[model samples]
Target: MGALMLKEIRSFLNSITGYLVIVVYLLINSFLLWMFPGVFNILEGSYASIDSLFLVSPWVFMFLIPAITMRMFADEKKAGTMELLLTRPVTDMQIVLSKFSAGFILVLFSILPTLIYYVSVYQLGNPVGNIDNGGAFGSYIGLLFLGASYVSIGVFASSLTENQIVAFLIGVFLCLFMYIGFEQMSELNLFGNADLFILSMGISEHYTSMSRGVLDSRDMLYFISLIVFFSLATRLVIQSRKW
Candidate 1:
């Protein structure tokens, strides 16, 4: 499992495509938080917090993670290497997890550099560290889980298709739907006072709760469940190749 995971990581880092994904993610977020002259600009915002980073990152990740994982299983199947991989002495679950971990780590790499934003905000605070450290920390954690969930979804989408473009499109659609579509539906009064319950089924409600520094276990569990569900779904897809 570890070897498979390492290979997946190497496949990304040793290639231009991986570097492009990381660079593009950083460039866009950096421009929005630091360079752009608008509401997203930290310096122009009313408060000296990194709220803009948190606000913009989720949307950016919706597209970025799909790009990273689009070729995970899709390329393997496209090049006809998936059969060789499956014949190896590893369970379907391990293969699924290895790919998921590699993709999740790539997301983490994209996010880690943003700590600079946190430090810059800290210093730029009213009294030089007067910012809400707890909230910022919580939001970072929320972002990590959110990205992990997206990775799982991306892996599942890749497993379902041999075409990278199709995988990418499916990933983006699923992530966008789970992140916002459910919440929007719940707001239409369609559930008849079960609106909050329906909204809770989506990622936005829990993500919003955690971003506020609340750190509820329910939110954490929701993310974990989503990751597990998608990972298992990927494993099942891989297993289906045997039949």
Candidate 2:
């Protein structure tokens, strides 16, 4: 599993697409937060906050993560190596987790560079340190969990098909739905008193709670459950090959 995980990570770093994805992710956020004159612009807001980074990253990940994970299993199956991979000593779950961990680490690599934004914001604070450290920290945590959830979903999507394009499309749809579809559905008031319950089913609500600097265990649990659920789902997909 560890070897497979390392190979997956190395494959990403050795490829131009991997570097391009990370670069694009950072460039978009930087332009929105510093250059573009709008609500997301920190300079224009005259406030020392990195909230814009948190606000924009999940949306960015909706596409970027799918791009990253689309070929994990799809390429293997395309190349006829998936059968060889299954014969390896690793369990199906281990294989799924190895790929998931590699994708999550890549997501972390993209996110870590944004800390420069946090440091700049910290220094730019009116008092040179007036920034909400707790909120910033919690938001970072939330972002990591959100990225993990996306990676898990992407991995599962990849396992469902041998075509990378199909996997990418499925991953994007699932990420978008998990992130906001539930919240939007609840807004229609069709669920009656279950509206709040419906809203809670989406990632946005828990992500919003964590962004407020509150470390709620329920939010953490929600993210963990998402990751685990998708990981297990991917394993089941892989197992389906034998049937």
Candidate that would win on lDDT: 2
* lDDT, candidate 2, 20-135, per-residue tens: 99999999999999999999999987678999899999899999999999999999999999999999998999999999999999999999999999999899999999898989
**lDDT of candidate 1 vs native?**
0.93
lDDT of 1 by residue, 1-243 (tens): 889889999989999989999999899999998998998998898887888887888899999999999999999999999999999999899899999999998899999999999998899888899799999999999999999999999999999999999999999999999999989999799789899888998998999898887899999999999999999999989989999
Q: Which ten residues in a row have the lowest lDDT in candidate 2?
A: 43-52
TM-score of each model, in listed order: 0.97, 0.98
Candidate 2 residue 147 C-alpha distance from true site, Å: 0.2
